[model samples]
Target: MKKIYLWFTENYLSIIVPLILLLIWESCSRFNLIETKFLPSPSWIIREFFILLSNGELVRNLLISIIRVAEGFFIGVSLGIIVGIQVALNKNLQKSVRFIFGILRPIPVIAWIPVLILWLGIDESSKIAAISIGSFWSVLVSVVQAIRNVDKKYLEVAKVLRKDYKTTMLDVILPSTLPEIFTGIRIGIDVAWRSVIAAELIAASAGIGYMIMYARELFQIDIVLVGVFSIGLTGIVIEELVKVAERHLLRWNTNIYQEEVTRKI
Candidate 1:
């Protein structure tokens, strides 16, 4: 009990702030301080969330969305890192792709939905493509900028040691850039989420975005809010997962660097 109490004391603020806000929101809704149409009572949304969950609609749609995000994020981030490194290091490579990427990158990924629908059709392919494209830019730009921003001093150290291209990149450039690259990856996640939703809203017959849009059409605002909350909550979960992975990987990186320095000395 004491341990639980201590844990609560440490973590209470995080819980309490949202709880307080929910109370205020519930009061407003109950008192009609805010219309139930625009801002449904917390209780109503919770009730709807459970109803959807019990009926398996929410789980099915959420699972579908999760799979789509996983596949698209993997493909997009893999390509982004591979291309970003080459473009950053190889002027010739940059020259080849720069013109087209420059033209295409300026356009928002959401704007490509109509064209994607036309080319790929309103199926999983089109939606996944939308997510991949949306996830690409943030990571690509992050990697490219990270390489450019690598401390010249590190390069000077590599030169002094006469490190080969592959060795230098593996040991120096990558470690130097991982943090920034991860930052971009974090941004790409949000983009990926938004892209999936937009694609679903526009063309999908299923998924969370479709659920929200369908609810809107029927003027089921409580259901709409439930979908909105589901998306937000799930997005938070995904980001937290990434952050946990980042912390572990970064800690490992630090250990590797220390071992290398110690060995050299």
Candidate 2:
């Protein structure tokens, strides 16, 4: 009980500050101290949220956005991991691709929107392409770095044990790089989600971004706020889920790091 209380005390500022600000905003809006037209009260936003919920409009748009993200994320991560491993293992491949990747990687994902719209039209394909483009370079770079940074001593030991390259890569190198690769995956998901939203805002007929855009056109600030908050809340929920998976999957790493820290202490 004491430990739990101490933990809450340590973390109280995070929760309390946000809560206080939200309360103040709600109060100001309700009292007309701040124009509700621009910044609606929390209650107005909640009411608008329920109105959208009852109409099923929010669900449909959210589903479309989620589908685009999933499709792009899976395909991008697959190609990134495979190519990254190949490039890491083969100097020739790395040399051939590195300059091209470096040149293209710095380009912002939003910059590709016009090109994708021209090529794929303002449809699901264009949105997915935007997300894929956004995710691919980041994942590829992270994967390559993770693979290259795997302990060379482990490879030497595997060779001494007469382990085949396939076995060594799958059992030793891949496992060793799992944490970093997953970090890349998390980044990929985040980038893909943002790119998807941007794509939807620019071109798509259906998505949370589209909903917000439409609300703005009609001057319904409450609906716009609902869409904005929904996007932020969903991102946070997905990020938390990723963190939980990371903790469970990387328990071995957590234990190892904890032991090292304890030794230093």
Scored by lDDT, the top model is 1
Q: Give the count of colliding residue pairs in each prediction.
A: 0, 0
- lDDT (C-alpha) at residue 241 in model 2: 88
After superposition on all C-alphas, the RMSD of every candidate to the true structure, in Å, is: 2.6, 4.3
The digit string of per-residue lDDT tens for model 2 on 1-265 reads 9998999999999989999999999999878899888888998899989989999998888888888999998888888898889999899999998899888999999999999999999878888888888888778888899988877866776777788878877777777788888889889889998998899888877899999899899999999989988888888877888889988977776467545333322
Candidate 1 residue lDDT tens string, 1-265: 9999999999999999999999999999988889888778999999999999999999999898988988898888998999999999999999999999999887887899999999999989998898899889989999999999987877777778888888778877887788899999999999999999998899888899999999999999999999999999999999999999888878766667646633442
Q: Name the 10 consecutive residues with the lowest summed lDDT in model 2.
A: 256-265
TM per prediction: 0.89, 0.90
Give stretches of model 1 more than 4 Å off: 1-11, 95-99, 160-162, 252-265
Q: What is the C-alpha lDDT of each candidate?
A: 0.89, 0.86
- With a 3 Å backbone cut-off (N, CA, C), the pairs that clash in candidate 1 are none
